[model samples]
Target: MLRRRRKFLEEGYNCALCQDGVEETIEHLFFSCSTSSCRWLVLGIFWNDGGNIFDKLSTAKQAFPFPFFMEVVMIGPWCIWKERNALTFNGKAPNLATWKNDFKKEVRGHLCRIKSSLHDSINFWLDAL
Candidate 1:
């Protein structure tokens, strides 16, 4: 069984997203947490066995001709962090439906902001979704 940490809070620290009885550390938040793991699996569906998301993002400018990869890298962590904060501060629960809807909106917004024509990029994003 996972031992709960009681370092900072008056009560024990529980993961706001997964509630899997692990302390909320950076490692847990981004990779080990069940919630994050699920998100990563779903993201993998889009990325298609691209190793790590951060690895791909770091090479975006060199490997990818378009800015879509950068947008995905930027948005994925931001959305996860946002969800964590919402759960921590607002007592909100994890809702994949809302998360996915927001992701689509953010992706659409990012695609629209690209200055060049994105015919193929748009199709790629649509297919990925």
Candidate 2:
């Protein structure tokens, strides 16, 4: 991948978080990086067992608290990617605690925007957090 070639070009290539021996491929970035993996592990308590985030999300659609579940699935990686970009482009570091708090706030904001009855969903989401 082009991203893996950044090192050959003298551009940034290694992961911003771990700086381990591997190139920053999508798989390593999203699934294998120490930082991202830790984040995913935290969220995994709520996620159904599957191969990865997308796989778990696809299987989660049938479960109740649909909106809450969907928001977590959609937003968790989004926030991680946003932080990854910040670190890549701005030399910023990943903040796991901040990311977790921000994720909760994002989920709550999304739930508020929807009109569905969320009594059970809210309780579930809060318990997961």
Candidate 1 on 1-129: residue-level lDDT in tens?
Answer: 112222224445666688777888766777667787676555552332355656544544365444455566567667788887776666667787677667667666676666457646655764675
The ten-residue window of minimal lDDT in model 1 covers: 1-10
Worst 10 residues of 2 by lDDT: 1-10
lDDT tens digits, residue span 1-129, model 2: 344345434644666667776788876776667888787767753345447767655665555434555555667778788887766656566898877887777766677565568756665765676
Highest TM-score, which number? 2
> Global lDDT for candidate 2?
0.66
Error of 1 at 79 (Å): 0.6
Against the correct fold, how does model 2 do in TM-score? 0.64
Q: In order, how many clashes per candidate?
A: 0, 0
